[model samples]
Target: MDKVGETVLEIDLEALAHNYNYLKSKLLPKTKFLAVVKAFAYGSDMVAIAKKMESLGVDYFAVAYVREGVLLREAGIVTPILVLHPQPVNFEQLITYQLEPSLYSPKILVEFLKTAREKKLKNYPVHIKFNTGLNRLGFWETDVDYISKQLDNRDEIKITAILSHLAASEDPDEKEFSDTQIKIFKKISVALNERLGYSPFRHMLNTSGIINYPEAQFEMVRSGIGLYGYGNSAIEDKNLKPVAQLKTIISQIHKIEPGETVGYNRAFSSEGYRTTATLPLGHADGIGRQYGNGKGYVHIKGKKAPIIGNVCMDMIMVDVTEIDCVEGDEVLVFGQDNSADAFASSAQTISYEILTAISQRIKRIIR
Candidate 1:
């Protein structure tokens, strides 16, 4: 817990363990847990986070691309990984790494089958994704018959699970819609099981779905943000601990007089004498331009200092007129005390966007 000398993202493994256990507690005893480690584990050191989760006995891991899965494998991760949105070009590499692909479309399925057959593989594990309501990826419920036809006599791939995503599992107003999506998924699962003459495990719940709808736990549950310490609701957020804390040091202090401006294009003109502190992180560091001009604030010595003027590519100035902090003082961008959700809310965004938008250049300190 030493003060940060430079911009760094402190990752707390203990907090991660707490979040993982909290989310797992919501599932049934027999249900499996799949931890999503894509986007660099929500921008907090993917290999480190995956290694921690693997040690915690995670049943499976999911990534958005085949390269992510390969990275985990190279990092010595042996857990089965599902490439959520794999492309046909990576089929060979995906198979080489023993990474399972979620075949959502007919074209992808056929292409992957061709690759598997060409390799003379038998019963390669794969997951079938259905479009319950997300509309982003996955096969439609009506496509089950087509899927069955494609795999009719082919034994190159085996269906390990059938899964879908919930569009609005966190919104109370969308309860009916979420329920309907679950029903459709159940229908599709039954039909696919009957067609294949075998039942693959089924899963549809994301973090919020796990919180709001326990009845639809199916046979496995997937958690991404929840394991990263967000529950999509205030009530549940309290039970989880934020695993990443973005911290930096004040690079310099400025004294602004009336009519004086700050940052590029003179975005802010001081109305009165004020003090400002420049931080060594900005748009290039994942603090987007939208957070400029009083839209975002940082915590300096427990006081909120509103950001002023345009955010620079490598620096941002925050008004610290009322604070007693000076150069080299540690500044908190977001942490357990000031959650990422609260920080993102100041600029009309969500925790997921800000958390995942963090740049890889920032140093990560694992505790």
Candidate 2:
């Protein structure tokens, strides 16, 4: 924690490597891996995480926008990056940066093809996202024939892989639906390969897919939250190592007499004399007000301090009467000792939302 600010996210590169190795072990021998490093690598410093992944021999990277890919390229990342949802306007920049675009719909395909011709590109790598059941993005099942017709004798845009999204691969109750989605993806891949006269790589499994449907992990699989120490399962969740530890120091301590109030709107009134510690993190720092009023708890001296009153933009009050602590003492907001999953559950949210919602302003210290 040397040179760390008032509040910081300590990213353990060893834990990240452990999670990557753990997940990679679940795949077959020849299965390639694509790490989703979008949204600043789930709010854990994208450039740092990407560099680590590159060092670990990751096959590909996925980002939501072309600008993210461009930034990675500018940072000297030579690994192939897939822009999952690139707009037509960014097609030229994608080609210029050598970023592969996932052309899902007809419009994207046509516009990208036009851009390729205009840029005098040939055999540019691209991925086709087919809508198996998620229906969020990608070509529908009916668009298979249309896609083949559009790509007839077109060598400028070469299809490198076919991929799809899994709606609920981790839920046991939705296992049947996930299987159906896999079936649809397989059917589409077969039709596509027959029409194109050559089979390209096919991948449909994401993080949960790798854990739940390893048998269907075609040629490659993508890992996202799992690499950040979440598996959406009780068993695997216990095995993965949490990468980020969110911590802050107690800024000040207040001795409140009975009936005294704290924070805005007098949301908390001390029934009895209480000792409280004010932290430097607040809603602006991604600790939402929903976690206030005793919903979320922080760790101090191995004891839990429930939050009091409404969380402010720059401060939060926690009842520390039971814990032995002092001003400037380190407090665990969420991490190895205080699980983000448990903290998020108190706020009625998932760990993903809590982790990604951490503000980018907070410095990330990699260990």
Candidate 3:
């Protein structure tokens, strides 16, 4: 492939491996690891990242939709993929590719069983997601008995695991709430297992949960952002290496006079003579308009270049008066020198949103 045009996401496979081993060290020796490769593995290449994780010995892989799993399967990924939020329409394809579904509700369980029966497939592996307070998806604690009773006689679908999402695992102020979630998850799993006369893998830890609630590692843990780098805390972040870096080049440079405006709506007018650079990327590439008007910045020659005007659809003007930069100078959007977390904080968002929001149109290169 040609050298990437304007911007590219450089994916460091070694950094990815470092993060995996870092998180794995937090788990008990026998606990299993599931790399959450959903959202294109946090906006890195899904096939490539999944391939690396598979080679690194991840016990399983997970994706938010069935299509993501299908993509990996098509790329020859043989790891057990758990579809976190599978729609009923794709259940057939899910089974055909041996991709497991996180059956969270009565509708899903019943429909999956029905689908399995229709296809004459037996012992199809499926996971159950419980609503342990996140209340986002999954069966509620009160629904455990119902789930057990419904699956008691059905041999067509096999329950391979029971899992839950932590509501506020990273927030230290919500430790009590997180503890309650863990307790509720344990109770539901134990009750459901006793009633069903068998046990499956039971886990309830996310990236933050693995760090904040290690004792509750259960039989396995699912990691997402941490695998890509940000640990949601300064202390944890120090030990992890970011896997992706967004880079671009200064396409053009302009000298603005006092009272001269830069971009749309004249959002940034120069108070005095100022040097500015235009980068060939804008809100359309996942850098939202909210980052305009000096709210965000980029690194030019290791110096800060603040966004000056309203971020345009395909370009952004940044004040580079302090930096002696020219067209074609390298710009670091976020990576080793500029933290994605800090950049998102400037936009009043989180790192996950910024990282995953990166436009898929950007080329990804794995090192």
1-367 in candidate 1: lDDT tens per residue? Answer: 3787999999999999999999888888899999999999999999999999999999999999999999999999999999999999999999999999999999999999999999999999999999988899999988999999999999999999999999999999999999999999999988998999999998899999999999999999999999989999999999999999999999999999999999999999999999999999999889999999999999998989999999999999999999998899999999888999999999999999999998899999999
**TM-score for each model:** 0.99, 0.98, 0.98
Write candidate 3's Cα lDDT for 193-215 as tens digits: 88988889887899999999998
Best-to-worst lDDT order:
1, 2, 3
Model 3 global lDDT (CA atoms, 0 to 1):
0.91
Against the reference, the lDDT scores of all candidates come to: 0.94, 0.91, 0.91
Model 3 ranges with Cα > 4 A deviation: 1-5
Model 2, residue pairs in steric clash: none
Alpha carbon deviation, residue 24, candidate 1 (Å): 1.0
Which stretch of 10 consecutive residues in model 1 shows the poorest summed lDDT? Answer: 1-10
For candidate 2, lDDT tens digit of each residue in 305-341? Answer: 9999999998999999988889999888888877778
How many residue pairs clash in each candidate at the backbone level?
Answer: 0, 0, 0
Q: Candidate 2: global Cα-lDDT?
A: 0.91
State the weakest 10-residue window (summed lDDT) of model 2: 1-10
